[model samples]
Target chain A: MRRFSAYEWVRTAVTIGIALALGYLVLVFTVDDPNGAFKWFLWGPLSRMRRIVELIDYTIPLIFAGLAVSIVFQAEIFNIGAEGQLFMGAVGATFAALYFPQIPVIHVILVAAFAMLVGGAWASIPAYMKAKWNASELVSSLMMNYVAFFLGLYFINYHMRDLKAGYLVSYKFPETAWLPRILKRYNLHAGVFIAVGFVFLVWFFLYRTRFGYEIRMMGFNKNFAMFSGIKVNNVVLYAQIVSGMVAGLAGAVELMGLYKRFVWQVSPGYGFDGIIVALLARNNPLLVLPAAFLVGYFRTGAYVMSRMTGIAPEIVTTLQAVIILLITAEAFLEFWKRRKIIREAMKAEGGDVQ
Target chain B: MNEIARSILSAEFVYSVIRVSTPLIFAVMGALLSEIAGVINIALEGMMLMAAFWGVIVSAFTGSAWLGMLAGLASAVLLALALAYFHLNLRTNLILAGIALNLFASGATVFLLYLISGDKGSSASIKSYVLPRVDIPLLKDIPFFGDALSGHHILTYLAFAAVVFVQYLIYRTPLGLRLRAVGENPEAAESVGISVRRVRYIALVLSGLMAGFGGVFLSMGYVSWFARDMTSGRGFIALAAQALGGKTAIGGMLGAMLFGLAEALSYTFQAIRIPSEFTNMMPFVFTLIALAVYARSVIARHRKAPSSSQPLEENTET
Candidate 1:
């Protein structure tokens, strides 16, 4: 009992081992050629430079969403409204892009910035209430996600709907308003750099600054922080608002960088995925890089997998749900079981001090 | 202003309230039981979605809406078992476990839909039995209230019955005491020879059963078919009702009715030429405002005198 038991490590190994086995089973059952499908699922994305660049492009919004969720989670707020915020941000940017299409190129940045502002403001409503009134953010934020969805649909159907086009979508956004592709050959936009910069900024804010320290303290024990004279409410509110801003910007990036027009019927659940990413990263900003990549890779591969194997693209979603369940459960149960055995052994040994 | 006042007071508005409140009643009651037993069951959305799907699927097979209701309950109980066991025994994060269940339910239901119908959007094409409406002959004798009570689905009456049932169960029964004790103070409950773990498992199972009925009501009672994620945000709204009601059965019911009213108005407002989307956001917007107002009142109360079982600490401990 003194040493780390072999059983504990085996459990950890088994969880991951089972996850891989499930993935392989899915591929084998779903695909026409299981052997070839295995290679595509694991290694196909790494085959070419363009595919790698495409991976970065796909990873951009996910990274921002991950960082956003991580920031809020650090303050112990579960902002399930990430999808809602992102949708609003996209709506804000879409309106700006459509109406102010004649504005200068530099002014478009302001529009994009305003989209972030609006998105953050939208999320702030829930955060403010949760901080002040002891409201459940998980509930309010999730409800807001639907509110965002229907509102976005309304905008596209009425205000931004292109009469020229037969579909219920906005008019084509002017090229000037479209974010510049950093690589001419690829769709990789300036959003990648922006995502990376935010990652560093978040890491610095969380680990280095007093505000970050306050957030972590509040997250760990709100009463302890309150007793220590930290404004627990303000810290939680700030974390949620800032998280909303990052997620909001991700929406703007997705709208401007990838689309010719706003066509989303609902937020693509990026914010929901962000929760899983944040959990996998253990709420560490720097750790979000690998976490986001794994998610983005699976997402990118899922499309190809579906095309190649006839498996639905949502298989990755199942993988994500399993991974989060594993991570969240692992630490607590291990601690509880180990602590129980220790107490029993100590009682048997007369409970002497070391 | 006069038109707005007229719209607000219309009979259509009352009808809307009844329509929306029906699902919220199921959801809030489900949330109330589990929350009282120390498990935060946020998987209401997933449970509702699965129940809705199963309800439609089962009705299509059996040609009986009652069987569909039973199927929905069965599906939810299975989910409850997974969530309850994992949270209680494995000491997993209940919220995350709820999230996992929700994710799994959403994907698994959709996958099953593909397997059954080969269509992705909805199961409308499948021949499904609709839940029969219950016309109360005597209740219709009463004036304004009778109209509200008459020609409602069976589940609607069941929802009202559930509120009274839950109230009695929690406030008057021994099982209720054990459930509340586990939630209020688990360590103390354990010390008193009550199985805290067992209480939570029972609460979750019951919560799932209630939520399952809610889901069946959606497809069989209301729509007669399951669309993808058609439970939509009702489950979350129910969670909001639980919060607003302060986890009490009556409070939860009142909060749910209010939300239902807001939702009903949102639809009614659409008839009066108001943009449907803006009206749809009414309940959520109201929830935010209510939350803010509630927060201010709590702070005001705190200033007067600190309450025992502080908000931050009461729910924080595992």
Candidate 2:
């Protein structure tokens, strides 16, 4: 198993290298100053301590979202509603922060709890539909995202709109609900600790628990798990709800740790980014940390590159897409493995003749 | 109440419904074809966005809507071919590949738009050719129906015609039989000399073409320019429509119309002080409800007669 994993690691590294080279070629074709663009894309984040700190801050939600997706994926449920759940979490946290300004330490805790509850509630609808009707959670969860987005927009535009603000903005979150920054100089907050803690917690839960084993079994084969007396419906429901709660917590953390108010026009695609992170990590909770950081580093560097080079930051998105496509192409790895096996067999035949 | 009734009953409302449903109908047809062939083309959203962007750019450059549409179709087909190669030949997870492609389309379209137009939001500066609206000569003279049916873009009429075409192709052709056989049991079909991969490729290509038409209509017929992420969630809505339609072409059309009506009603409702957000959410919420209801009915039927004909299992593989 270790040798196979090492082989998989090598294959993954090679795929990533190829994807990056292709992306650089695309940049060369599109941009006049390809060298400058490439420099900024590859090294801008590492060139500054502030940028590195920002990358760390951005990776917090990514870690949570990755873990969220990995959890549901383990149960073989495609609950893509993390995007919606995150939005709903922001809404919940904002509501709590704005409405209960009197409470100090408790207010922050309450807001976090509310975010998780709202996120879980949002996911439960799709979970219910899937459990009861065998309806495609993929479709329902996806459709629900728009509803959640628009609903969040409505709340910000109407109910919580700060009329004095020039643009559409929500009322400032109360000071009492603010999460303390760990590194005040760089604006890093306590959420990073929570994110790191979740890595170990999720790893333990997925690797050591009986429930996690059931989830893994179900993911491996639903019929076999069902015949083995696993209650598939309840497991699916629990997995989706827990996944949503984690995503919701990410939103709440982002809001309290970064923004002063509800200013999100649309989800920043953190949920989708989490999907890629989970995929890169092969759904391993512990591996999600490095995966999220790698993605965050790319994003930060891309942002700086676009700012410096007058290119759109969306170039990073294109690169991410290429990486995802290459990584997920199963045949690429298999083809190479087959060739290696054939070569080894030929060598063995030659040795026997000698 | 009287205001609601007046707006709902107006000829303009019916026209709006038809106009709104046109692109959705195209996407639904595309999704239905792919789903029936056991390849769920969730990349319809990306394909539509790519076509929409290219269709507008090409029309702007060439000064011809037809040429623009051909370019759009070609672009979608190219993406579809890539999807087929990666998913079928490479044995990648189809959903993951589709998602990646959708992300690629979303970013690439905006990136390309910015490079060419110097604007990330839209292509409003470019003067693109719009598809001409056609009024049926004899039909335009009809009393009540004239106002509702006449003077729509040519693509709208084609959308309806394509429904009939798709239905005929899927039901009456030997190709359709082989496609269905391949989807139901690929090994069995292979033994009988049907190429499953080839059928899937054809289905994906046809799906891409229909999605291309939808994208072209969005840019050229619905509006004269492409906006970033303008296809919005319509592609996903079409997927819902396909599922709600039970994988039948005609039913998909009806489902698309229902969503279109919801959108049109939302537009009207906005004038009456209803929150546009709630109205905007109606179609998706309605889809969820419709799906649940459909599932319940199917379950009830199963319980009533265990050995009865299974109607909802046609596209359950994905």
RMSD of each predicted structure: 4.3, 2.2
TM-score of each model, paired residue for residue: 0.89, 0.96
TM-score of 1: 0.89
**Model 2 stretches with alpha carbons more than 4 Å out:** A1-4, A339-354, B307-318
After superposition on all CA atoms, how large is the RMSD of candidate 2? Answer: 2.2
Docking class of 2: medium
Q: What is chain B's TM-score across the candidates, in the order shown?
A: 0.94, 0.96
CAPRI class assigned to model 1: acceptable
lDDT of 1 by residue, A1-354 (tens): 013355444554555556657777866675568777666667756777777887787788889889999988888777778888998988888888877746667646865787889789978978887776766687778777877888888887888888888766788888877887888887788888788888999999988899989988888888899999998888878888888888888888888888868878655888888887787677888878877887888777766666666656666677777776776775544765687789889897885653
lDDT of 1 by residue, B1-318 (tens): 687688667655565577768888999999999989877888888888889999899889988888888898899888888888777777678888888889888877776776577676789779998888888988877776676667788889899999999999999999999999998889999999999888989999999988998898898878888888788777777876787787679999999998887777667677788887788778887776666666566567777787643463256234
Residues forming the 10-long window of minimal summed lDDT in candidate 1 chain A: A1-10
Q: Which candidate is the best by DockQ?
A: 2
Q: Indicate which candidate wins on lDDT.
A: 2
- Residues A1-354, candidate 2: write the lDDT tens digits: 013365578777987787678768978999998988989989988888888888898899999999999999878788888899999899888888899754888988898999999999999999988887777788889988988998888887889989998887789898888889887587888899989999998888887888888888888899999999999998888888888999998889999988868888867799898888888888889889999998888889888888899788887787788777877788877867887789989999999999
The Cα local distance difference test for each model comes to: 0.80, 0.87
